[model samples]
Target: MSNIIQRIEAFSQLGQFLSQFTTERISKKEQVLHNDLFFDAFKMQVERAQEFNGWFTLDNVLFSCEGWSKSLTNENLNKFIDSINIKKNTPKTIAIIMAGNIPLVGFHDFLSVLLMGNSVVVKQSSNDKHLLPILAKYLEYIEPSLKGQITFTEEKLENFDAVIATGSNNTARYFDYYFGKYPSIIRKNRNSIAILTGNETDDELNGLADDIFRYFGLGCRSVSKLFIPKGYNFDKLFNAVFKYKDIINNAKYANNYDYNKAVYLMSLFDLLENGFLMLKEDTSYASPIASLFYEYYDDSNSLKEKINSDKEKIQCVVGNGFIDNEIAFGQTQLPTLLDFADGVNTLEFLNNL
Candidate 1:
């Protein structure tokens, strides 16, 4: 327990250190541990992260860090841990196969494993191989006990007692076949959606813009689809979301937009566009970059039933007074520590294992 408390303190300190870098800029503060050692190095890591992954823009990387900084507060950490019972004190090596779609996407799993007195062998996606390793180094420096507890490998996993793997639907099958012998949590592709009632305030629509535009709609929590009322006027939605038009300036995003738009044009699919984002009437939950799929619903109950039936494919529902436990608009990316992926209580899973 004393060791766990020390680990918590070390993570909190890391939060404080991460707070220095925001979407605005990266600034060093004096009280952060090993500032002289890690501050500049982390900045270089951020730059290299973008160079390595085209989706990892500086703004997105800093935004991810900022969210982590806020989530790693002592109060939040305690609250998250308090909900679970940690009885597995004997350390077991847990293998984590992470997704590369977003920055530090696997940190929550990593933290969960470490906080539960387990070792982690992380198999990071090649696209997101930069940030978390450095942060792990920082954690090891702050808490020397964590040095051997955490390991990264590019090769096939071995000698791990349990597994946490995240990937698309196809890779999930692979994970199931390979890691089925172990206690495991394998996640499949899931996307988020929004429900619009035509009565939403402009502020709410604008907030939805953040949910859609953040991370370029690559995250599972990003709003990739919308369920709007029949005959809804899209002018207001377009007007509100247009504030994020600057996103098209990104070369990668623009290329995707052009490619998807050309494909849609060739296929004769109807699309609504405002120069940056395109909206298509599609039934699929996952939308390509720079595009969102929307479906018109006749009533809320039927829509609710449909959503509930397809819950496995959905990550979150963002709306106003639409669904129970729905995420508020613009807040999908700012998940609290307790917001475990796939609604599986990660801490509890680790604790019981």
Candidate 2:
């Protein structure tokens, strides 16, 4: 096999490593799987990654695809790949300061750096301290030699050829000031948004539920804001999300819902004509419940312009006939090995650099 193909194969095996501790059959460390909040993170990815060989295969296949390996639209890939192909001897180390908003958000950068033949030094998030090591450990079990290349550290960020960091808007400024001197892809505060027309059906809305509720709506990829058409009825939207009412059952989430609800009611009793916890209303991308997010819009074009003006603050757009429950956002635990951060084409960036 070609050397490039061989490298892809080696890295793709990480899926197997991560899948070993199936998200379903939680390792002994997990005291609870499903609870008052929702299915625990990695609750879905591990089972699906392990059982669905088709998806696992697709994950690996897509990793090797030009769209991923080249990390650019087809037009951009050709130019980038040609340049990289000519610079085989250039050595690089990519220091990734990963976000822990959703589980395994860091993995995407990890895979990209590895596939491109750049060594990685990762500084993990404090909140989400699990999974990466489990993945790294399993990968090493299968291929002992790779143990050296993948590592998790609390190390200070110094002496790296390049850097990629994902964090809050406040932190981004700091990251920029500290790390901007070098080649970097430092991301700031950004949230995904959904645009809605009144015509959406039950299935479409449920799909949107995953986008907003997954990772308890904490990640940048989560729907921090939403855009809906004028006079959109909450009845229809709530009806769509009702299946996930169980999200309230999770203890942490339930606490958030209750706490926020009480605060809203006490602060503005008359303004809150709607009930406790989540009220039906027009508002913004931030949600009312502990594990929810929302935003409402009256004019689609106006909101589009608003979003366009602030594109850096927004991530993916979800809505209307396009939403599908099958397509998860921030597939927290088992991120597609190829998904790049900040929608920036890392390989293309490297090639151009």
Candidate 3:
């Protein structure tokens, strides 16, 4: 098997390959490796993803690709790898059960297991099954030694040393029961929130809109709720996010908006809405599609205590300076490789295993 350096180069090459598919356009770049063998096939897979899953629109899939392209650079990969201590040991096959809520959501775990010189048997979410296998083929073509190291499966997983599973709260219970004997990391439902001080500039507010609306708020990093100061003007936020009004044109998103809106109206819930988005005052972190739940905070200290108490339910906190490790306005989705999900260090977990 190739050493860690070679593995890094393979992923960096994969990043270059992904650069061709972005939100702006999908044009082939000649400099990327194995383009003749993989480019068009990968493009077709992107379209197939959109056709198979209503949430996986072309723009959203491309955005995911674009994010990976940026993250897989040589500098970023090296930095991420250098942060961890890699022990030369016999390889273990790690079982991964992935969620399909957003495009390539499980790719991070897939990459992490491989980078640690471990084999992976992936059970992908049917909602997001198309893109990763083709990309895995690209990896094999770039580094033939990796061919047998990666495996995708629909059958029951076996012959693995450890497990990592992501799902909703209900499925998490099952994962805990079934994988209890192994060294495992089980992730359940969690949502992101933003803290607003009413002093944000228009650009900052626009960035916040990206944090909220990107991926149709399906990813765990997506901001689904807000904590704003008392008497904060809603008009400022509504005006800033108006540029994303075109999101309503997507049939699936529009359907969700209409349905959620009807339910809210029928329940006599007070809501503040623009044509595309609706905001309701609530305490929950996971808001339904097309609606953002917000809470009024009288003071920052109390809000901080509240968030700290519910840390397990929160993913990324979007704020300027409200708390330690707060993600700046719209940057939640652009997490670096070191930003482990659920605050569990995946690389460290794999290393310890």
Q: Each prediction's Cα lDDT score?
A: 0.91, 0.55, 0.94
How do these models rank on TM-score, best leading? Answer: 3, 1, 2
Model 3, position 326: C-alpha lDDT score: 93
Off by over 4 Å in 3: none
Candidate 1 backbone collisions, by pair: none
Give stretches of model 1 more than 4 Å off.
Answer: none
TM-score of every candidate relative to the true structure: 0.98, 0.72, 0.98
- When superposed on Cα atoms, how far off is each prediction in RMSD? 1.1, 9.1, 0.9
Number of colliding residue pairs in each model: 0, 11, 0
lDDT order of candidates, top first: 3, 1, 2
Worst 10 residues of 2 by lDDT: 60-69
**Model 3: per-residue Cα lDDT over 1-353, one tens digit each:** 77899999999999999999988999999899999999999999898787899999888899999999999999999999888888777889999999999999999999999988999999999999999999999999999999899999999999999999999999999999999999999999999999999999998999999999999999999999999998899999999899899999989999999999999999999999998899999989999999999999998888999999999999999988779999988798899999999999999899887
lDDT per residue as tens, model 1, 230-314:
8989999999987888899889999999999999999999999989999999999999999999999998899999999999999
Global lDDT of model 1: 0.91
Tens digits of per-residue lDDT for model 2, 308-335: 7776666666654443322243232222
What candidate 2 gets wrong by more than 4 Å, as runs, is 1-3, 17-89, 141-147, 269-284, 288-298, 321-339
